[model samples]
Target: MKVYKGIGVSPGIAIGKVYVYSHKYVNARPEKISSVKAELKKFEAALKTSKRQIKKLSAKISRHLKKEDSKIIAIQMHFLEDEVFVEKVTRAINGGKSAVESVREVLQEYEEMLLKSEDEYFKDRSLDIKDVGYRIISNILGIKNELEFIDKDVILVANDLTPSDTALLDKSKVLGIVTDSGGLTSHTAILARALGIPAIIGLKDFSLNVREGDEVIIDSENATVILNPDDTTKAYYLGKKQEYEDRKKEILALKDIKAITRDGVSVTIDANIGAPEEVTKAIEYGAEGIGLFRTEFLYINRFELPSEEEQFEAYSYVVKAMKGKPVVIRTFDIGGDKDFPYLGLKKESNPYLGMRGLRFSLANIPMFITQLKAILRASAYGPVSILFPMVSDVKEVIKSKDILQQVKDELIQERRDFDKDVKIGIMIEVPSTALTVENFIGIADFFSIGTNDLTQYTLAVDRSNENVADYYIPLHPSVIKLIGMVQEVAKKNGKKLSLCGELAAFKEGIPVLLKQGIRVYSMSPASIPEVKKYIREITLEGKNIPDGFHQGEVDGGL
Candidate 1:
């Protein structure tokens, strides 16, 4: 028996035969063409065909999956629509290169640069380019490309499944996924989680070791894969699979129940989402409200800025859907790992410490005002609060509030219908902000602790870097103390405080945070069920609230 290990992105188990799926590798040989005009025309036609196929597939997938999942295909369409990509390919073709060769050469260069980066975000983006490049070349060559056919229950193994390739998968037939190249943030991993499929990615060359119809046992709970398991091992895994399924069912049973402690402490469970479509899943999972609606999705993966009308429509859709539940829309945290080319941002040696979050929005006054106006307009529909990310100074909070008031005055002059008393909040992600929370109690309405960035900045470790990933500990004594300090200050001031980050969903960290006086926890929608179950199991009998603060009084504001 052979055993392989990889990162388990989606949690589950599957004991089945192997289904070795493969994509037709397109090799564009360096062919020299005589007619530049003819080659350019052929390239343009191929691009159009590829785009149409993507749109059709996107429409088809939206009918079955969440609209956010269908967005994977829409992002691919952006690749075809990007002017920089088209111009580079066109320039290469005009220099006497064949359409197919120009596409392969240009995309290969782009992919290579991204692959060389340490960031997994860049690596995932390269896969999209690779997927789009493959389709364009195949269309140019007249090679009929179709999704892999799965006939029965099997562990689907591949080199790497692209976002589009994973979207076309038959979720019912594929018991599990094992990919040779992928991380937790990869598009395939994201789709697998959305589909509730068991996935183990980054198993380099595991496909080469297995043959079609070979018995495979995927233990995603432990990130283990066993090939040709013996009877004893099979029996052990069969029992394990049953336990995992039972645990899932038990956790899901808490969907309708409130996330309250056994000792009579109440904590609000909310979901963080990138787009309005994800609000449906959040509600299905029993999210009390939308904690962090990342507004950057509207700006990223596109060639131009999203107009005010576009932003207003999206914010309104989410706000109305929540039906009066408090929705905290974080104004575009764009920079650091999430960068847009249209912003014309300079390349910084250290992007995390560079102009990001509130700094970026403040510097670009026009863009910030447009987003502020859209958010304020949407507040008329339901309870909406504007959240500023990566805030460190007291002055930043005052400056932002000033701009918000200015926008409100402008809307009033235009006779626009909007909520005049919209709540203003700031994220306490920086160490400096957490340490000085007392100063902001009178300035901001509420505070949310972004533990992801707090841990990174405090520990001086890049969470994305694999070399020092072990040092990125969120539960370190110093970090936990910072969280406790912020909770204490917020509670003393009677300002509602929520914790939104990966740390919020952590089962081991939740009890500690509750003991530290945090009352609101926000996490990914998928994690809501499990986290609620864990919270229901927790009891803080001996834990006393600091300063005799009433627990019921904290759940009042945004």
Candidate 2:
């Protein structure tokens, strides 16, 4: 047996045949169409074919995955049917361009539009249009390409894989994945992690060096790849694989088990989800509830805000799918480093400090109320919680609660069925919130520390900026003190609190949080098992709690 090593992204072991997705475009000779009318006819036919292919793929996705996972496909179908896009394509083709050239020209224009966008979500979605366009052109040309899945078990290597490509992969036969392009936040990386397949992305020249059906062993923990291994290395990896499988089996047995520590301490293991389709995957990963449901996705990617009924339908579907699990829906937190062209939010000089989170919601009160009403209406179906983001003071908290009450009152006066008693909470992210925790103690139902922003705000470092990314550390003395203070205030007020930041999933941060008296930890479902294992191993009985009162304890908190 031979072993090849690559960077491990997701953590799991599989032995499968290699499946290579070649999305290479073949340059074709320019076609000769006599007139604009003929070119228009060809364009129309291509559009029809694209629509049919989109619908077929969408149906296949709906059958294989949840609606949320299939939402992008549905959106692609809408794009194909969009009047503006159709008109653009028609005009281009009628201007005496070949069918493929017209489609390519239209796609280039759309891609430029997306690139000019300030929103990362919309910017990343530019690839979707390109993918769909490529599919249309390939299908029209009668290309008979096949995925190169090797007959023997091997790791799948690619430049960058898409969700559709990953879906086509036989999970039973693939070992792991290695890619030369992709980031941690990309959909491809997210899906691979969710599927429990070890993946390593961002390796330059990985595709050039790795050949088809090459035996490989990936150590994801250290992000290392070995190529053409010897007998001893193969033996070592085989033993490690068996040990990993055994541990996974043990964790699977705890799927339905509560995440209670040996000392009778129970912590809620919830999932931080973006779209409604993620609800099913959350449940499958043993998430007890939806801790953080970012609702801004509903307002994004369109020319206008979603109607109240549209928001209600989407929120209601997610709540119903959860059955009775607590779903905490956060109001729109946009306009900070993130932007929407349709909202007319101009590019800011310093977006992180500008209008965002609760500030943005308060500015758009009607938009906020619309979302609040939808959450209230959905609460009737199951347990729902409302959370406000980027709050720094009691005034913002009170104002938001008042607006929520106004919506409830309006619904009540109109004799509408809405839940008035939905729990209200605040995301403890600002430095002032951390310093004046007492002011919000009794007013808020729960406090969820968004360490991502809190760390940035406290250390005066922008996490997204690579130059200062290292300075945006959660282990910084100031950041640790703020978290400890938040926990102390929550405990003093006899209120429940949880940490719903990326730090909550960090092994180092989890121990610190447990010592600082944080009992609830909310994270991505994929991180649950390893986090649980870390929590289970720590003995807190004799551990000294890091008190934020003195600078020494504050320093120790880090």
Q: Give the TM-score of each candidate.
A: 0.88, 0.86
Task: Tell me the lDDT of candidate 2.
Answer: 0.72
lDDT of 1 by residue, 1-558 (tens): 989988778778898999887766563463568699989998999999999989887876677566555666777787799899999999999888999889988889878977866445666778887889888888887776555466688888889988777877788888999999987668887788778788899899999988999999987766898999999999999998887778667766778688788888888999998888889978888999999999987775566899999999999999999999999999998788777766778888898898889999999989999999999999999999999999988888788889999999999999999999999899988999999899998899999999889988999998766679689888999999999899889888899899988888775677789889888988888778877767767788535322211011011011
Candidate 2 residue lDDT tens string, 134-252: 76666545553344344445578777775556655565556688777655544555567655678777676677776666566676765666666677877887887787778677765
Residues forming the 10-long window of minimal summed lDDT in candidate 2? 549-558
RMSD of 2: 5.5
Q: Which residue pairs does candidate 1 place in steric collision?
A: none
The count of backbone overlaps in candidate 1 is 0
Residue 444 lDDT (model 2): 90
Each model's total of backbone clashes: 0, 13
